[model samples]
Target: MPFRTSGPAASRASLPSRAAGRLARTTWVDLVVAAAVLVLLYLTLRVGQGTTVRFSTSQSAKVDTDPARLPYDAARSLLRMFVALAASVVFTFVYAYTAARSRRLERILIPALDILQSVPVLGFLTVAVSGFIALFPGSMLGLECASIFAIFTSQAWNMTFGFYYSLTAMPRELDELSRSLRFTRWMRFWKVELPSGAISLVWNGMMSFGGGWFFLVASEAISVNNKDYALPGVGSYAGAAIADGDLGKVGWAILTMAVMVIGVNFLFWRPLTAWAEKFKNEQSEATEVQRSYVLDLLRRSHWPRLLGYVLRPVGRGLGRAARILGTDDRPLTHDPARQRTGDIAFAVVAGGLILWGLAGLAEYLHDTSGLGVFGEPLLLGLATLGRVLLLVAAATVVWVPIGVRIGFSPKLTRIAQPVIQVLASFPANFLFPLAVWFFLRTGLSIDVGGILLMALGAQWYILFNTIAGAMSIPTDLREAMDDLGVHGWQRWRRLILPGIFPSYVTGGITASGGAWNASIVAEVVTFGGTTLTATGLGAYIAQATAGGDFPRLIAGVAVMSLYVVALNRLLWRRLYRLAETRYTL
Candidate 1:
């Protein structure tokens, strides 16, 4: 038999089967749920439509750098990161879920998302600050919201991508089981698919959260109309210190960020990792199960039980609501002509809008800088592309082995999570001195320095994702390999590498995106009045940013986005197909 191409719908059952489409059970809980669902839908409709908030950022922002305020600053940054992370989760659920459900939407949405995430945090920050400040005139809430939104952009994309892949690449048997269960879409989502993707979501979410900290300076420090604004956070404090050329204050800020990152990992991510281990897709439980001290403590407490008891009614109500809503499993009529027509319409509208935006950009560039501006950035982009490819490949070589060891050992994972997260969350600006020192001492150019700087912030994407993938390999599969006398290189070749290939691809793509963004800051280095610039797209963007040349910035960003998306489509996608065919869980 010829090789088969398994599309997303081939292995997943978010669709209604004949039995489920016919009838479902009824109860008072169901009635109450139905009523609640109606109320929710009404509220959603009322809130879904846009309401304009006035945009203004005339208010001057400042940060106080008292060491006494370190705790407060750390708290603010942590709060923003977590809040943004929460929002990212909601966005991932809504955005990725919708895209996954509809092939028409997926075609447009996925590509758009690739472009969106490729936009640098600074690019987003520039536009968001003014709008958010205007929305909440005379209130600090605007600045806070702006910071949170910037962090959201940093954190959401990786998570959304991971979840989208997980949904589509679900195992064939599980998809069949879901359809056979007579599940309505809601039931399918909550009971089957959601649980299925839980591991990927949690792990990827953890990575995104860590990556958000990499852009803390960009998020917390703002500049508009030649005016500098700094939010009261560790990031802004560090930025201020760097500006003042005070290494002491910078060191203190690094300490604060490290504490915040490691503490959150212990309290939040480790516990989630331990909890999500139960959801692993395997017939036999792993011999070494992940454990977390925080989770163990919580389990040993009465608080969780009490809370569960208190929220039992709410849980029941939601379950009932899902049952009632899902009972209507009537499948939509599949009219090929109409479907094709709708797809064409969607493409036309989406393509027209994109082209319109591009045309506007081109017109602006033509008027101000001329279309010739694109030439340098394209050449610079190729330089950056080489660096990015090398970064991903090198990081993969370094992290994969370590990630495997960490993921396969429950104790080691629990211990390493905080340490790894702290390292990942460390901002590159704080380490500029080290890069500069090495460059000066070794006589290496900014080319090598660019790679070093890019790796500082982006390597964790590969490490954390590889760990997630390694942990998810089925226990039964391992045992089967062992029983078949598979060992050492053969075991790795046949099982380990293939099992983690999908996750590695996910990690590699996100890491590449992070590296591209990091390049803007990485390629152009300045510390102690010594500035070193690499000849790359990143250097062009950095110089444009410094000069406050909006046109150059736009061109650089556009070109950079094009490069990132091209890499994603041309390279990572083939690995995605391989994972789908050979290693899907």
Candidate 2:
């Protein structure tokens, strides 16, 4: 009636203007996000209620692998992962903050973290499950607590490392600027340090989440002391499928997991990456910025502002707590005597903790076994160590080049992001059958195949960290490299390696630890009742776990922890210092 355009050309020309005019900035997206979030909370709460229900041993062995239950099971498993993630974040912030602020603590905490990272989830599961079950007798909540803790151990260590690196490696210029501004420690932490490390935190948090997923089966389908504590989840569903030789159910689990992973990536991480772009400390805008529709919609909506208003009192409370805790009186004092006293006190406390732990461990070993308690496990650890080192080396050779290339091209990264995430998140157990098949078909030994399986589980750590490292290299520097005609090996030698070295150290350390843990899963493989065992510490640990042999599990875990700590202290620790001190941007 108003002579509106109806022809194809006119309609096409008017579409954008009409769409823009018709779009309500806050209405639709706000409603959608609110609805989705509320629904999710409801679902999580509904699933969590099952945690307090009565439990029985027979229930664990009778996981119904029906495809119909896959969605509910997936939701339950996802809830566990999220709860563990929340705990891991809390641990990372507190632990890394303490260690970063205290030199003495750093010296102790870093090595302790290395040892903790090397302790396999099964090791924790074996001990934690019994204690938790005793604490909450005849209830599913205890098993839930044990499972969440297992997932937390898998996630917390590398995240702490990332945050610690972030805090410890702030640019000199930023530190000086904060000094010039006479910033309080809390203000500096809030304004400069946290923002600087936010990117690393997000990326490493992503990696940690994937690691949780990689070991989800172990966490969800647990067996301690020959009592099946397997909870109702996709993990138990899949494990039961594998045991029953039902490839079809396994396929369903895979599909369900894929959908869940993809949904989370698109809805959560992609948006976070786009939001994090504002925190980048570059001289020029990135050549290609990350974009996510969810982020865009949120930015255009009024909900964030509304929510901030509603949460103001909570924010103030947190701010007051931060002010009290983050206050450092040390900087105001030039008294060397006071500093020395503090140092002495710190050392005494740390030494006492170490001694107490060692005494208990020694006593336990004494009580558990007679002779050569740790000797065979130590030797087996060396075998596993050989596999870890070799596989890490190989993964570096393969993934570094690929990761660098991917990182350099934002478009390629955008296209490949989900693919890489899925690949990393796919649990190693799913692929065990393939490895077992290869071994059966080719007559290759598990000793060699074990390395491959470990690489499969652990290599993503290297790749993801390398990609972050490459992306963080200043765009201005790359342009200068181009202007100076830097090409090929020289480009990599001069710009790439130095730029990525610090990140590579972080990645390599985490990757090696992941390989150490993966050995427990990889060294022992089963596909449809056909089992293969490799001669390594991982197999020793796995066998002990299956048989519910507590003393043997502890022995294997302790030796593995010692080997990992020694390797980190001797090799990776030195490399870490070199990179942090010499190769920073």
Candidate 3:
């Protein structure tokens, strides 16, 4: 500051031995988590492969089936899903940065994001299949590559939202500290934002995977209007068995899905939970410690050996380079004459849109596919719009009070969070057959089945996020409200409602997108080959996929996407802005 305090700053900056001790304690926890996960994985593989691990389901017309080879299938699916997940992490960071801090760019980003999310995964399959085939003609691997990209769409959006919320809601002091340091963009992102957002993003990732699994059957097993392509996967296998009413394979699918979910939770989630705990600023002194596996592994490993190697000449050289380049904790300064660029650079984005549009058009026009039979764009648009509204209303009405109640009560919040997490993780497709059975037995309209399927994923988005928002309300504000004798409707209107408004908006945004996904199953049902189809965009796209009409598929997707974009821009954006100004500080 005023006095040159640099001589003492180095001493002040150094961490004490106790910090090292605490770190070591955390490392031990990580190793234990890692070992448990590894053991579980090995056992699941063995059981899934073993001759003794056999089960049957009603889907196979009550016939018994063997699960001896499911280990191979599960392993393969898990590997691919993990790769897609990693890619999702990268996409989320980019999305979060643009959405949270960029003023003008956020305006464009939020709507564009809404559209991107609203377009169903099935729609991506329709567009991607033709593109991949063209990208690598006569290559079987090309088709598989296309399939994985479809999966990416399902996983990325929720992750993006998680990062967006974390960055936007970062503590004010942290914000000032970042600004004062004049940290480079990369440094700020890596050192500050990433840690803050990681826990929420990880949870969102888990939820996204659950959402993705709902579409797995349709994604892994490809079909467009009788031109069917079944890629070798548990999804394809499950789809095949389901189509033929192979109940035994259904049992195998259920078992495999359960094992994977539990295994993932134990391995990936446990360590992340531990690391995330470090980010919390305590309201009270240390009470209880949560367990972590990765921390354990980090401790027990040959860290000393690694550190010794790193402390040598080459490592010292690298460290010096890092310091010189302002890659360490130093501030970076650009020349005053060189002005900083505005966010996202709108001109660049416009150019990108043009290029993307051209590529899409070029692909569609060259194919010479008969896309006309898929029906009118106006009809598709109206159908999708109706479904979106219906689903949002349903989710809103159900989750609002539930979320508010959970938020205001700490004990209730803790209990509800885990329940919601489990429900969110359960794939919606698990309820599909049950939905169909109930509807049929009750003589309910086929449309109700579609709504139920859509609600399955969309409802959780609102419920869970609402609870999160509620639980996060500052203790002081709650106390002030209580002291004022606020209760019932007045309490909700002034305190609870305003407190959770931002989260409610986010939940609505996510729920609407989920509705689109739910439509894939909801609008197009194939119960015993007597398809009960809804009159909507989803049905139109489904028909195109079944018919191999790529052009019509693109048209349907485009129309639906445009509608989504328009609604988000005109309606949701206004609501989001209101939330930001009125509720968020």
Q: For each candidate, what is the lDDT?
A: 0.81, 0.84, 0.66
- The superposed Cα distance between candidate 2 and the true structure at residue 327, in angstroms, equals 3.4
- State every prediction's TM-score relative to the real structure: 0.86, 0.92, 0.75
- Residue 343 lDDT (model 1): 82
Candidate 3 lDDT at 190 equals: 63
Residue-level error in angstroms, candidate 1, position 13: 34
Model 1 misplacement above 4 A? 1-62, 305-333
Better of 1 and 2 by TM-score: 2
Total residue pair clashes for candidate 1: 3
Candidate 1's displacement at residue 222, Å, is 1.7
For 1-585, candidate 2 gives per-residue lDDT tens digits of 586667778965764555455354548777887897899889988998988998754564578787988888988898899999999999998899888877767878888899899999999998898889889988889889999999999899988988888887888788778868876665677789888888778878888999998899899988767777688888888888887777888889889889988988998888876676677767988778778988988887766766655565565676677667654533534688877898899889989988999888888778878446788898888899899999889989999999898878878877877888898898878876677789999999999988888886789888988887887788889989999999999999999999888888888899999999999889988879899999999999988888987778888898998898888889898998898898888
Q: Compare candidates 1 and 3 on TM-score and give the better one.
A: 1
The candidate that achieves the highest lDDT relative to the unseen native structure:
2
Per-residue alpha-carbon lDDT of model 3 for 1-585, expressed as tens digits?
Answer: 464445656544433443455446655555565576698688656533432222221112121134675666667566557767888888888777877766556766766777789777877787687787777666555566666787788888877876787787676677678768875555567678787666556557766776766677777777754556655566766766667666667777777877776667666765565555565433533334345555566546545444554455464465455456553222234443332243336657776987998787866656665445334876666866787898898778888898778655645643554456556655555555555567778988766567776776677778766765665565657677778988889988887888778767767777777877677677876544545677777777777767876677777777777777777678776777787567763
For residues 1-585, write the lDDT of model 1, one tens digit per residue: 885556666433422332243225334444554565598577544432211233235545556778998976776677678789989999999898878777878888888888887888777877787788778886667778888998999899999989988888877576667677776566677777888888889999988987889888878887644666677788888877776777888889988888788778887898998899888888987777877876876665444444555565575676677677543212334778877798899889989998998899889889998999888899989999999999999998999999988887888987888888888888888787777778999999998778988898788889988999988888899889989999889988999898889899899989999998888778877777778899898888877765678888888899999999999899988888888888886
Ranking by TM-score: 2, 1, 3
Give the winner by lDDT: 2 or 3.
2
